[model samples]
Target: MLILYTYSFAHMFKTSSFLMISSTEIGKYIRNMGMVCFVCSLLLIIFPTCGYAAINTSSTLSIGHTLSSPNDFYELGFFSPNNSRNLYVGIWFKNVDPRVAVWVANRDTPVTTSTANLTLRSNGSLILVDGKQDAIWSAGEAFTSNKCHAELLDTGNFVVIDDVSRTNIWQSFENLGNTMLPQSSVAYDIPGGKNRVLTSWKNDTDPSPGEFTLEITPQVPPQGLIRRGSVPYWRGGPWANTRFSGIPGIDASYVSPFTVVQDVEKGTASFSYSQLRNYKLSYVTLTSEGKMKILWSDGKNWTLHFEAPSSSCDLYGACGPFGLCLRTSTPKCVCLKGFVPKFDDEWKKGNWTSGCVRRTQLSCQANSSTKTYGRDTDVFYRMTNVKTPDLHQLVSFMNDKQCYEGCLGNCSCTAFAYISGIGCLVWNGELVDTVQYLTNGEVLSIRLASSELAGSSRTKIVVGITVSLSIFVILVFAAYMFWRYRAKQKEPTLGVVDTSQDAWKNDFAPREISGINFVEMHTIRTATDDFSSSNKLGQGGFGPVYKGKLPDGKEIAVKRLSSSSGQGTEEFRNEITLISKLQHRNLVKLLGCCVKGEEKLLIYEFLENKSLDVFLFDPTLKFEIDWQMRFNIIQGIARGLLYLHRDSRLRVIHRDLKVSNILLDEKMIPKISDFGLARMFQGTHFQDNTRRVVGTLGYMSPEYAWSGVFSEKSDIYSFGVLLLEIISGEKISRFIYGE
Candidate 1:
């Protein structure tokens, strides 16, 4: 009996220290330590044996009893959801605060009595029975053997297994309850018309299924969808190579990589997330509010990584048929081009569900005798950066031009969009749930009457004529002034420099730039609250930057050029002209520019994390820039420089490349900003000489600073200095001084 007790003690601990001791040695040590040691050893052996991770046919888990996973990562026990007296058998995270339940056995059928028990029956089935001895819930189709047991795994999966074969008969993961753990999938069998969906809880306190159900739609190329009853509340759009076509926010470098497994033979598709980092506990949950959110825990608290239906525009058909939803707009909803509000008064009051109607009817209808049989009178208006409307009919083996012709041939076809991955999608019914995105959206072409097209053409022609006439008058006046000045130059006693409006116009002429808004001064003033001191972010060489909130609630950084600054009109114009045309992810986005009187403001996207200099210089913040983050920042800066040097349409050289110019976004992604000193080169023009060497002292290259010769290599030298500063968490000036 003593030998047996010693062996059991060694088996219970299973540690290297305990395993070192032989049975004979353990018995001898117990005898020498007396009854106290023997009793303690016996208790240690019995304690773990009494509370096992798995329950055999002989064991039962009554109310208040719990089964913890081997590693104690998860626990399975009877739980009462917030404010509820009823009990449910569920599995929850053991280490998490506020106990996050992942799987519930009896979610819909809760036991009212406290005497409920979870037991492994002789038939190898795991059953939950209430105080009345009634089976509340059971694992169906038990194994024939009597040696079956139920186990709670570290993966948060509660499984009923046959001990003899060690095969899992049933698992809690198969019957999902709102949450999708890492590697767990939401599957759909297209052939069977069956799916494993996640339904939202009724409320925060209740575990019962709510109105919202999230599942993968069985389309040709499957996509995720959230449905409220029978209608789609929010769609994940069609599946692209990397992510959902509609969700541009889910990038390739996201923490969780979403993968859809499509089995053509089986006709099954499953959407699952593969976590890049296993140490971090993350889950995709269908919230009570009908929003699907991905959250991760950093050992302390849960942080929301991403959420679907995040905006008012994300709601399906929010803008209705023939309407476009713009989240950045004040009203959020507007009619498509050549369409007017169905109810003007209701639309003004923010009721957009009625949608819009065409301003002019199509003349290509079959009933119209004036319509030509071979020729169509309808013209297609191309709308870019838009989410294609719902109820699209896919037409295969058709190119873009063929799709356009096909749509024009049919009077019933309202609109058509050709996606890269998906074939031509033509819409016959009214276009519904169309959303206009600021970036990364499909192009949609809507058929309009010739009269409507003619109206747009006439407006453009009138505007062109007006602009040409205005320019001609200005040129004629400037010519007369120049002639008078030249005649006066012959008899001049002292030379007078021209600094009038005409001179300013000659120096700072407007260029034909696209994708940039010319913001009004009054609007910017209102947004920045009349340039209040509290709104001021920081002052630079150009001027003070102020944080402004637009009428649409978009935060912007307004870089206002000071009149007293050395770099004024030329620098402002240079920045506006250069950055406006450049497009890159690592480069800062220039939203618009405002030129009113003395105020020359450039609007930029508000980066919450601000410049790298702020973090690198500060002792407390420097810790955030670990080795990995610094490496990523270095790579991003390199990519941005490469684009400026070779990849971009214009071969440009950023004269000023420093830590202060490297801005960091909320995700700590570095974006190179401040193109005030950027110089654009013509084709094959690699180097340029300038008398004025404009740049920070420490960051300026030797060739650029001394000889006034600048090239792409000058930026590379500055980048090398900045890279060292980032890695060492020290400024270039400080490093030089220390050396």
Candidate 2:
């Protein structure tokens, strides 16, 4: 699955393309414009905005009014929380229910009445004021002298940009809310000792700052921490290469990783995740109860995928310092092998916060020089399937043996874990937040006195290691076999095409398709929201048609061939070959296509008014079209049909000509669509015969419906039927075929 992106300004419009219009020229242009443009100009001149993508200083956004993101993905306006009287200016998803606010400007100072105005000042700033003209919140410091305007991006970032320079003077992304929208990330400023943080809303009804917050800590190797005020509520382990040391089991293919980067020159460390399952529109929200959950919208519904501190065992310092938290254990908390509970009574009461103390001190800590690890003075006790402790220093030791000896040499080193991704990790002080998962966790070796290890038999340790390795190998083998079985059972899926992509080989595909642009399946998924139900327009014999907008905001109508349709492959190839050869203003233009295994899509230039049937068949919309409009549509259809039969390079016959196939463009000009069942005539051929009849039931001609013969005359008869339907507003029911 992929996410549709509208984030970068560079891709939208280049600054060099902007034509600077002076005040005098603007006035001249306004006077010369048409009535609609004149009215819009008046609105922009006076109040500037009622509804639009961007707001200049001349614009005033009042209550009940909103400025929507370009694609209408996000809205910025004054809104009151559920059951709350006060109103605050916030940004929320345009389609989401319950009005989930992502950012609030007036959380602390809300207007009681519905007369507040969010005004952009000449100083390149925005101010929210109530009816009394008292400022609620003023923000955005000017960075350049260029005239700036504000816009809400599809990524949910509110930015002030230089209208001419296209420079980003200020942005709301710098000042984050409880939600981390896509393209937004937390960074640690080492020199300033400040970090970008997400503070939760106080409660469901209030946007005032809450007690819980999530921030990236700038420890050499930075880790994420959810804090309750100054105290840590939950730890997101450490940035151990591709994963966190303490929070394991995240598939790199799905759950994204926030990799750390230390800028030596700038003296700052930052971690940002540029990839998610579908990166651009995904988000992570910090809840009121102080939990981070990652989610994404599939157009209609938001799917929650991952959550942190999911269990009590995952909570920060659940078993306190030098304590281990295991989900399977009866009490869930226990002291290490070489340690005992500091407070025995509290431990028995299941209050293990007091943690544990070493039963015997390490030899190095005692003598400072008599360190003989695993042999005499001190020994390392291995704890498998466990999360390494917090605050562990990154050790540069290359191998496990070197990492072990490096830790053994240091009297202060309490434990060490050598992981492939992170290399080596050695904890100096007391260990905290150590968790034991059932599977896929790092192993931590704890340093202890030799006397504590003397009781444990060498055979038991060797047997345990052997059994763990054997079981791991068996599980991996079984998983691989299961995956293979599943893959074999599943129907073939589509992939990016280089040569007959999706195993859909065509003799003409290699050469004929050289002129046709092939889109990636990823791009199609992104544009159509993974072909969600919301994007679907209508179902036809071919399959379903969906409305989608490309990254450049170009709208396209995609007809996806159903996987189970036995005849779809042939029809798909027919449409591709026919439409690609024909080009006309009255005929639907074929943009491109995507072919992957069972998936076949035909992309067309989208008609805004949709097909003529929508206007003809619908009761309310029917009245909207006058006789003049109907006559124009009739003429346009006639012109399209004439071109298809006479003018096209290929003498193509759209065998499925019907009211539904006659699509109406933005200007209400009819353009013929759907060439899946089209036929072509060779030199001196006027008619074609077929055993199979394939077309919409109502649009089939009598001669073609009964017999196998079809020609230009037969299409003309169907056209006459379509014309009768248009003029009389009555459909001819010709159910002559199964299709």
Candidate 3:
């Protein structure tokens, strides 16, 4: 049953060199060499007993002989299971421990004895017949008149073919069951159900099909699901044009990359990967415990690298329909906005199956007279950072805006989300199997009755108004008290910033100031609308930045550093001392400064354009910067680096030069911002080495990324990487897979 064999003997060498080898050793070697059994015997004629034999096979089935595939990596043979009288034709890795079985020819009807036979027919099919002359198993329907061949490939794929046509008629990979090795699939032919699927074993001791199965569903979004009987246990959420959102926190740890496809004309979906090293072996399998696991071989044994449904949130409907599962909390169910517990008492008792109900009745049900009555009363609530719900209707041949309008125009739509590269997906019924994500995914907008929305809006407006009135009252009272006190006192330190005085008195004494006055908290609160969430730009180690416009219509970015934020304070001081002294179009300009109680703020002239990463790394924005613009960005970054290293007065080294720190002006000019990590070198100092490294990976130079040594040359190496990034539009860490 063995397809091929490999044998080497020392007798051939002994005879050719006229060196004597023991006669008994020669006979033993000849008998052990199965492929060239007679060749060894023939060599024994002239060389005495000093001969050996090696073997290879094309298409041969015998009582004892077997086939070791082309690369001799695996062997196909009839073997009995552990503690079983039944025999089976199975393929196992050659010379490896655990003797892992990739495929079984007669898993259900195993051979009862050693006399069981398996053969490759003249027709392209392979058949296994037991000692009782009972048909145990058979391969695909393939036929031939005179020429048929079977071979085992290095990938461990066994194939039956025709010698004349030389086309593979049958392969083990296409009939996969429980195990999915690299290149082997649970689903094969995309448009056809020639799709391979894996069914778990009936039990630990039985290889018969079990209740659990794993396969890809050719649904709109094309999701992979694991089911127990007909019920779905876990789902690899709809592939987000890029990857599955449900499986969060995927880094470079696993070497596998997955792909999904859906075509009405050619319905297909699949996933596959490549090994990091040649010697390592890996595969994905549906374990008996009803879990999908990715296992890899590390020479000695297989290792489990990843698994789906690894947490409670991974279970389908674990939190019930219309409920969100938050893994970070106890009793993980949370109602969506505008929804309340269906059974408050049951929910209090920790029974979440009742799920949630709309807090307000739908306006459509209240009125039937006019069509516009219900249409205008339905509002959409933005749901961010979520793993979108299931059972979707795919709408193709439209852009995001078109999809949005299409869904918005329909009254039956409950929620809708449009993804790039993959058209629109809309859900109309109850949203089920939804989980909140800590990582940023796509957004989903849920439809709610106007009453629910108005309540939410009213609450926000009331909070805003109350805060505004309180601030106004406090300011008026303070102003009155200050005027009366100033009238009575000879000297006053009341209003800190004023042209009447040349300096302000600090706790340490008097300090001269030329920058704009430290604006009162009330003025800033009014100008930036109390640092409202709507006006907020971004939050960092410093508190947050807000987009503020002066009374004169000048826009500015306010960086409000916190009192306890030592890092932010240092960054602020560094930026002020370094950038404020320089005047360059490629540097962020400091428009003014503010010092309030426990708040240190710096105002910079707001560029119409934002940070470089916002555009350059964005999927939609990347296309806007064509080759010409990308090249310009590269050259501009190089110029900025040259200025920092050579043109600047202090010969500064921008230790951090990531896309995030690079800002753009209206003309698309690149400005280097954030000097927190920048280091100034004394005259003629070429380089410096430190024990601590403070730069992003991929962009960090080899010498600097590995160690804390840096210089102008280090910056040059980093620039080279930046140049390549701009040219190829790929991250450095992703360079390994040609990402």
Name the best candidate (by lDDT).
1
TM-score of each: 0.71, 0.57, 0.60
Report per-prediction Cα RMSD to one decimal: 7.1, 21.1, 15.9
Tens-digit lDDT track of model 1 for 527-592 = 999999999999888889999999999999999988676887778878878897776668998999
The segments of candidate 3 whose C-alpha lies over 4 angstroms from its true place after superposition are 1-37, 40-66, 78-86, 188-194, 251-256, 276-279, 329-331, 364-375, 396-402, 420-423, 456-739
For candidate 2, write residues 1-739 as lDDT tens digits: 0011223334533556435767898687667767766675566455432344676777777877677787777888888888688898889888777567888888778788668788777778888888988888888554544477888887888988887888877788888878877677777676887678899988888888899988877664668889999989888777655556667565221124466676656767665555353333456788888888877676667777778878888788989899999856353899988999999999999998999999987657734664554345888898877877888888788778899988888878889988645678899889998888865567799989887877557867887898999999879966876776676667486433332443344446564564476788888889999998999988876788899989999999888888665456678888887887665557888888997655789898888898888998788999978888888788878877877787544577788889988888776888888888889987678789899987766567777889967888777887888988898776677333555
Ranking by TM-score: 1, 3, 2
Residue 571 displacement (Å), model 1? 6.8
Top candidate when judged by TM-score against the true structure: 1
> Model 2: what TM-score?
0.57
Q: How accurate locally is residue 352 in candidate 1, as Cα lDDT from 0 to 100?
A: 93
lDDT of each: 0.80, 0.77, 0.67
